[model samples]
Target: MSTAVKHDDFQLPVMSGYAKESYDLCKAHKLSFQRCAKCKTFRQPPRPLCNKCHSFETEWAPVKGTGKLYAWTIPMNPIGKAWVSYMPYVAAIVELDEGPRMATWVTDVPHDQLKLNMPVKVWYDDLTSEVTVAKFKPA
Candidate 1:
């Protein structure tokens, strides 16, 4: 298998193996999906057990980044010291087209502009050579 060569602009992912697929999807600019074996349901936030049937069989699937805003919140303050720089960022609950909900960062736009029921798509931020975090924002 080939690996991404590092250069002046090369970025790494945050994890490997399990989350590797999500990182790869981000690098490929697609949203990775997780599927439940028992329910045949697609999901995010990769799981080791099927939420629907409590089965241990689960699979990662790819998904289109488009979704509707299921819920949201404007944090009163950033918790960690590093996050202080981007205080008041919107933490959102998105209902994906596949019928699963995802908690991802909303970015690429000002926080004030976010509203319930807004359209959004997947966005990626490369955090390391083996990790890339997924976020969402107005589409």
Candidate 2:
């Protein structure tokens, strides 16, 4: 009955509630956001209530996965041993075309060349059968 998941000393999140719903969409290779059915506002980090109108109704709306690089930082150090090999990686915030911003790894692009508002697109990485994470790259 343990929900803990480990991969090379890195522990994955136990998917549940809204998080599990979000990751489930990623598992299907569809980048989605919870759109407030009342206000039509899309939000990242899915929640049961809408931030705009405080509506409890929402829907999983898929996006084009194309966006602009909102912000980023090159982490010079690893937070965990599992990320030691990935030091100096780009941690970025991507503003999706529909308007929500999501934190993701920006791959295949040098950190020196990254600029605010640069176009990026979503890509999927299957960390496990039930967990598919989204990353981004230069569009």
What overall lDDT goes with each candidate model?
0.67, 0.82
lDDT per residue (tens digit) for residues 38-135 in model 2: 88888677777888899999999999999999988887776888776666778889999999999888888766788999999988878787798888
Angstrom error at residue 135, model 2 = 0.6
lDDT of 1 by residue, 1-139 (tens): 1112223243343456657766677666676677887788665667677767878787766677788888878776755554554556677888777777877677766766777888888777555554556678789
RMSD of each: 6.7, 5.3
* Steric overlap count per candidate: 10, 0
Clashes of 1: 10
Off by over 4 Å in 2: 1-8
